[model samples]
Target chain A: MHVIESGNVAAANGVKLARAHVVAAYPITPQTPLTEKLSEFVDAGEMDAEYIPVESEHSALSVCIAASSAGSRPFTATSANGLLYMSEQLHWAAGARLPIVMCVVNRGIGAPWTVWNDQQDAFSQRDAGWVQLFACDHQQIIDTVIQAYAIAETVSIPVMVCYDGYILSHTYMPFEIPDSDTVDGFLPAFSPEYALNPAKPCNLNTVTLPDIRPDVRGDTAPGYMEIRHNLHTDMREALNVIKTVDEKFYSIFGRGGHCFIEPYNCEDAEYIAVCIGSLSYQLRDVVDALRQDRIKIGVCGLRVYRPFPDEAIRETFKSAKGIIVLEKALSYGYEGALYADIKAALYDCDNRPFIHNYILGLGGREIKTQQLLDALRQSCTIDIPVPQWIGLKM
Target chain B: MREDIIQIRWHGRGGQGAITAAKIVASAAFSSGFAGVVMTPTFGTERRGAPVLTSLKISKHKINDLSPITEPDMVVVFDHLLLKEVDVTNGLKEGGIIMINSPRPAADYSYKGMNVFTSDINSVASSVGLPPGIINTGVIGLFAKATGLLDLEPLLQAINIEFEGRNPEKNIEAARLAYENTMIGESR
Candidate 1:
């Protein structure tokens, strides 16, 4: 049924349709509404999941990790400080190879305290070995959440579906809620090979020495280093899994499948604006306006961050003369993290475009359509400087 | 002619349901054949009695812009008291529509370059036996009447969907009363 709803509500419906066995989270701004909706679903008996309200985000993720390790599909959500608080458990969940799905409503990190939209919160957790997927709108939020579960379970790795807080979370849009039977057809039940069962009694994650050890049967087994290596291998496999799951979803529902990075009007273009989240929705207008003036410029919204869609990045911008990366997070003294990744991806190209990074809209700064056009006009002149902060104070 | 995309800003207190009004208005616009409708609120910890601002953007196609509406085509003030506290007229487009929940005649209020419309939403709310404090939905009716951007039945439907309880009938009646009573003010 098509109903007008907020992104948080769409996300909660995604969890309900997926029939997540364990829903655990700490109530935080933006993200609080998502979990609250889930709690309502559980209370109304609309969903048959155990909704665990934990004391802190740390406990929230730990609950998910425990539930998933015990053979149940678990889900959790947080933003900014809450995600930071659970950083330790973030690594543990991936290390345990638990197929847990988490929604990180991206918010600006605090010192001055802002509860607005930004990608920094989720970007900070890039090294945690979890697949990061960013959605551009509320519909993508719903579609991605369902796909995240399938991808996570397939690779035995956790996935974090991140969308801009308040911008997407609080915004209302009309989206079709996929029926549970259709969702089940796309995503089957979880059946783990190994679990925390006393009848089968096996010590999971026992202390392994640095050196490779031989088993009781005299077979050489993987060491701690090998375990980490396997995690890396799985991360690589997730690239394919992400695409496959998105394709499966598109087949079921008429909407998804262009999963990794969404390229808009990039073909036959000389310049491209690289960005993520709802801001990209606005940039499309800038691109269209510029196109009317006959400036061949386009935009590519980076959807999946972790198993960084390097190939897609290269393929999309290979024809462009200049690639401008618009990011909401800064790496302190260095360029934006996305800028570094894009540059690295295109390093081997013989005719690499001048990749420039512009850190804009940090701390929820409003990015006007004219400002974007002005930046694009300035970028047209070669030798554009890196880390050009949009609407920055002196 | 109507714009390809319509931008509206809401001025109200924290407890006045400006966010709720924005969402319902966006939903109403979507149901009225605008394929894209986005409603957003000012992000922060909202407290009752504090100033709150919300925005709604409606387009015929998919809306690409996510920024707050800086230059609004229309502005709705849920509480007339907000006029003194905030510059409710700031960044309003030329000949923009301004709807306020005031008992005074629209002719009595004048902005330098805009059309001001007035309706006594509080009176309508009370006439419909709604609680004394809740006048947000009533103001929305005034908005629909003043702008004519959305159809009356869809706006009423959106309100009913939002308030899916025993009092939907009353809320719909209150909206109808406010719609019938809205008055157009002079643009100086």
Candidate 2:
């Protein structure tokens, strides 16, 4: 049924529908409402889950790790400093192959204390080995949460569904809520391959010996190298599983699978703007306007962040004359992370557009569509500048 | 007429339903078979009690510009204090209308070439025992009475749909009171 709701409430509903057995979270601005709604659900007996109120984000992820190790479907959410605090545990969740799903409300990491939208929080954790998906709107936020759980459980890996902090988190929109019966039919209870119990005691997360070989070990024990290789192979196979699960979700829910990249008006275009998060909605207006004026412009919204979705991105930009990358996160000494990834992905293609990285909306700065169009127009005139700032007062 | 769009700029604080009012107005125009777009141009960080600016565009065709409106055909100020902090009438078009929710006499305010409309929407809202945030609904009624760009019936319908029968009568009463109290066509 269609209902007007906030992004936080929709996300909480997604958690309930996914049938998460354990939810561990720490309160943070823009992310507090999500946890609050979930807490309400737990109190009202709507969700039969263990809601762990941990002291800190670090302990929150630790609790989720323990719960998921016991073969329970675990979930958690944090933002900015909270996510930074849980950085070490993020790797643990991924390396343990424990199918944990987390919602990272993308916020600016502060020295100035800003509780606003930015992708820096999640971008800083890019190398943590967890699948990351960026949602563009509230509906995508809800749908991606459901899909994250399915993908994580299927691959036995953790996944993070990221949305802009205050942009989508606080904005109210009309969204469709799938019935519980439909969600149950789509994401059935998770059945894990291993579980911790007193009856069958086994050491988990043990130290590895360099000289150990798989053949020398018994049938029950796998060598450290074999385990690492298995994890790598599982991640490689997860790409296909991600696509399949999204397809299945769409089959059930009637909305999913715009691929890892959604291409708008790219069929015939000379210049394109690549973006993520809520800014894409604004870009749509610019693209439509430019197209009417006979300016060949297009837009590409990147959904999947980890595993990077390189193949789809390269194909999407093959026909463009120039590419403008709008990023909400800045890499200290380096250019925007998404721009760097896209450049690396399309380095070998002939006649590749001059890729420009524009860092805008950092520390909660507002980004209007006209600024995006201005950047695109500038890209056509001069060589696309590196780390250009949009909407800056200077 | 080139059928050009009439862009409206709304100024209000967070939690005052300014964004909601813009959306409802746009939805009402769209429901009446006109094209419209509503957007919030937010900056820095927004918290409750902080000022916010939201814009709405009603066009005969699709809205093409997504930029902040520097000059607006109409300006709706939800708070009287905003006039001192920011120039609410800065880019108001000639003969444009400025609707403010203030108890002071409309003649007391100065507008060089624009028409000024004033109402005590908060008073009307309080009289109906409605929350102050519902002042937007009253402003929408004033907007309808002054501009005639949107039909009051469709706006009330949109409000009913949005509230889902919760406090609809109070909102309708507020709208009717605002419509009755608003004085338009006064040049200052």
Candidate 3:
């Protein structure tokens, strides 16, 4: 049914429709409403799930970890500081190969302190071995969460569906909630290959040697390095799984083309703007504005940030004249994290453009479309400064 | 800035339900055949009586931008005092309408040459057994009558859906009364 509600409610409904068996979360700004709505659903007997209200974000993911180990579809969510608290478990969940789904409402990590939106929180955990998905709007937020469970379960890797905090989280927009029965048909039951059972009494992820080692049964098993290698290989394979799941979801729901890199007017354009989350949609207006001024520009929103869609990135920029990447988070002293990653992805491409980076909207700073237009206009001229901080004040 | 979209800015204190009003208006616009309607409320922490604003965009086309609306085509004021506390008039179009809630007639007020329509929305709320400051729903009538942008039936349906079983009759009646009572102003 078509409904007008906040993005948080859309996410909560997606979790409900996916029939998540367990939900564990700690209340954090922006993300708090999502968890609160889940609790309401469980309290109102709408969704049959064990809502475990944990004390901290760390414990929240820990609960999901423990629950998923027993072969339950567990879900959780967090924001900046809360996400930072879950840093250790992020790797643990990914390394353990658990089919856990999480929503990281993107926000800036605290130095002095901020409770607003940014990509820093999620990007900081990019190397944690989990698949990351970014949503541009409320509809994508709901659809991606449903698809996330499918992707995570299929590949046995955790997934983080990231979107801008406050921007999408609080805004009310039109979204269609898919029928529960259809969603059930689309997403299968959660059945892990290996699960911890009390009756069986088996140990998982025990200490491993440097190389191939023998277990108590005298059978050879992959060692620590080998296990790490398998995780990396599965992640690479996950790119295919992501594509399959996207296709499957579209066939079932009729509302998804946002694959690894969802391109907007990029097929025919020369200069393309690349970013993640809602910024991509925001830049679309800029693309239209630029087009009127006779600038051939477009946008490529990186839907899957991790497993880094290197092939798609390279293909999109194969013939483009320049790439203007505007990001919310910076890699501290270096440059924009995604900008650097995009450059790294395009390094091997023989035909490439002068890619430039603009850092904007850190700590909830207001970003105007005019500012973006000016940036894109200058970047079309192809400036030399790598990471120009927009809206800087002494 | 787009010619096709109608941008609306709402001014009210934190507790006056400006956010919910914007949402209901967006829903009403959608029901009134607007293909794309987006509402963005003030994003951070809000305290009671502290000024807050929310903006809604109604368009026949898709709204892909999430940028702030610096200049609005219309402004809805839940409390007249908010005009003093906030710059509600800044960047408002000269020919735009300012649907405001006040006891005085619309002719008594002039807001930077923009059309002003006044309503005693607080009294409308009180007459309907709603608390005095709960004038958000009552001002919707001022919106409908002053702008003539939306049909009253869709708005009433939106209110019914939004306030289902929570005194829907009273809210509907309050909206009807305000619509009948709204006075259009000649810009000063």
| Highest lDDT scorer | 3
What value does the lDDT take at residue A203 in candidate 2? 85
Clash pairs, model 1 backbone: A281-B64, A282-B64
lDDT of 1 by residue, A231-255 (tens): 9998988999988888888887988
Q: For model 3, what is the error of residue B2's alpha carbon versus the real structure, in angstroms, after optimal superposition?
A: 2.1
Which CAPRI level is candidate 2? incorrect
Where in model 1 is the C-alpha error above 4 Å? Answer: A216-218, B1-3
Give fnat (model 2): 0.09
Candidate 1 lDDT (Cα, whole model)? 0.88
Tell me each candidate's TM-score: 0.97, 0.87, 0.98
TM-score of chain B, candidates 1 onward in order: 0.95, 0.92, 0.96
- List, residue by residue over B73-179, the lDDT tens digit for candidate 2: 99999988888887887778898889888888678787888888888898989999897567878888887887788789998888777667578888878888888
- How does residue A18 of candidate 2 score in lDDT? 93
Which regions in candidate 2 have their CA more than 4 angstroms from the true location?
A211-217, A223-225, B1-9, B13-73, B90-97, B104-115, B130-137, B143-172
Model 3 C-alpha lDDT per residue in residues A1-394, reported as the tens digit of each score: 9899988999999999999999999999879999999999999999999999889999999999999999999999999999999999999999899999999998888886888888889999999999999999899999999999999999999999998998899888899999999999999888888788888898788887798978878999999898899999999999999999999999889988668888888878889999988989888888988999989999988999889989988988989989988899989889999999999999898887889998999988888878888899898875668888777776
Cα lDDT of candidate 3 equals: 0.89
TM-score of 2: 0.87
How does residue A30 of candidate 3 score in lDDT? 78
